[model samples]
Target: MRSRPVLVYDGDCAFCSSCVAFVERRIRPRCDTTPWQFADLAALGVVQQRAAYEVLWVTPDGRVRGGAQAVARLLLNAGGVWAVPGALLTLPPLRWIAHGLYRLVADHRDRMPGGTPACALPAARPPGPPGGS
Candidate 1:
């Protein structure tokens, strides 16, 4: 139960759960995953809107990464064949390509029988203006 980086995932997604299970069992020194809803992203100083849409990796220092780079970072931390791809994805020229591929997969996750994947959380209703205006 050592404190480490946190992985935010969609708990309702079967694929996401499987991925988290992979990390929990395969990654030595095991990082923890928090359901996107329970982690208190804002309290953790994470930008909830940005992180909720895709995979996120929050390092111990509080920095965050999204898209394929996030997956690569986790892989890098996991220490194995993963490191090779992680190193490749982080390369500047290739980084955008990596993100693009990630976006494509994310865009159609539900079609894969992965679960009822849906885009975007519900819109937040802005609080009533100052003084109940």
Candidate 2:
């Protein structure tokens, strides 16, 4: 019976925290922001691995959106002028582009302003051979 959505992010990442601060001060989206480390992932319907991988937007109705889509949801919740770009980000070609851009930024977050080595996500492991090799 939660009323507002929850925005889950990496608290260990200074860059991510700074971005959240900016959103709170400027965009002011209608959601509760919590770092994944401090949030109850199971209750939010988010897995720990996925929460570690990207930002998440969990709605009151239990719909979960991640990464760029999460950003779009934030903007949409903010309403007013921000809603225009938010709606566009959910559309076709723009959605494709936004996904790519989000990945790029996520992959290099450690290099972004206010970021530290802690902001770097663990390197993705390649698929292993059969039999746990």
| Per-model TM-score on C-alpha atoms | 0.76, 0.92
Instruction: Score candidate 1 by lDDT.
Output: 0.70
**TM-score, predicted candidate 2 vs. hidden true structure:** 0.92
Full-model lDDT for every candidate: 0.70, 0.92
| Candidate 2 overall lDDT versus native | 0.92
How many residue pairs clash in all the candidates, one count each? 0, 0
* RMSD in angstroms between candidate 1 and the native structure over all alpha carbons: 5.6
Q: Give the candidate number with the greatest TM-score.
A: 2
RMSD to truth, every model: 5.6, 3.1
lDDT of 2 by residue, 5-64 (tens): 999999999999999999999999999999999999999988877888899999999999
TM-score of 1: 0.76
